[model samples]
Structures are given as structure tokens and as C-alpha cells.
Target: MYIAKINIMTKPEILDPQGKAVELGLKNLGISQAQEVRIGKHISLQIDAQNEQDAKEMVENACKNLLANLIMETYQYTLTKL
Candidate 1:
């Protein structure tokens, strides 16, 4: 078995209003130097794969086909043997 850890985030060029809101909220709470806050999603899944490379490929395909939006979001993942 293999475990896949995936992270999905908005593209740098895209605006993240939710992140900005959180930053502003922090500043209001007297948190100085809160430059930026970019939010993202972390997903973990177990795959019945033969090797690390195969697990990575399956996770990448999942991100491309369903998890991450190709136009606005980017994704990366790491595969660990279990």
C-alpha cells in the first residue's frame, strides 16, 4: 500500500479573497507583519499501488481529473510506501 499526500492551491495570478480577509482579520487583532495568507487544501489517501511511482501517477491523475481545477488551481503530491 501507498499513501498520497496532496496539496491544492490557487494559482498565484488568481485572487484569493478569503485569504486576504483572514489577513485583514489578523491585522485587526493586532497581528502586525501579517503580510499574506494563502489558503489551500490538504488531502490524504491510501492507494493499493505496487510502487511509489505508480502511486504518484494515480494521485496526479486524481488531482487533474477531479481534485484541483486546472484553470485556477495548482497541485502537488508526495507518495510514501506503507
Candidate 2:
């Protein structure tokens, strides 16, 4: 079995309104040190595969085809064998 951990984030050039809102909220709560609070999604799933390479390919395809928007967002993942 393999476990996939994926992180999806908006492209650096894209504006993150949600992140900005969080940043503002934090500052209002007296957290002035927080800056550029970029929000992202983290996904974890388990896959049954013959090997690491197959699992990796499946995860990559999922990220490219469904999990992330190529134009505005980017994603990266890590796989661990169990």
C-alpha cells in the first residue's frame, strides 16, 4: 500500500483573497508578524499499487486532471510505502 500526501496552492502570481482575509483577521487579533498568509489544501489518500512508481503516476495524474487548476494553481505530492 502507498499513501499520498498532496498539497495544492494557488500560483504565486495569483491573488489569494481567502489568504488575504485570513491575514487581516490574524492582524486584527494582534498577530502583526503574520504576512503573506497563503492558503492551500492538503489531501491524503491511500492507494493499492504494485510499486511506488505506479502509485506515484496515479497520484500525479489525479493532481493534474482533477485536484489542481493548471492555469491558476499548482500542486506537489509525496508518497510513502506502507
Estimated TM-score for each candidate: 0.92, 0.96
lDDT on C-alpha atoms for all candidate structures: 0.90, 0.95
Model 2 TM-score is: 0.96
Taking the tens digit of each residue's C-alpha lDDT, what string does model 1 give over 1-44? Answer: 99889999999989899999999999999996887699999999
Candidate 1 overall lDDT versus native: 0.90
* Model 2 alpha-carbon miss at residue 25, Å: 0.6
Instruction: Give the range of the ten consecutive residues with the poorest summed lDDT in model 2.
Output: 69-78
lDDT of 2 by residue, 1-82 (tens): 9999999999999999999999999999999899989999999999999999999999999999999999999998899998
Error of model 2, residue 52, in angstroms = 0.6
What does candidate 1 score on TM?
0.92
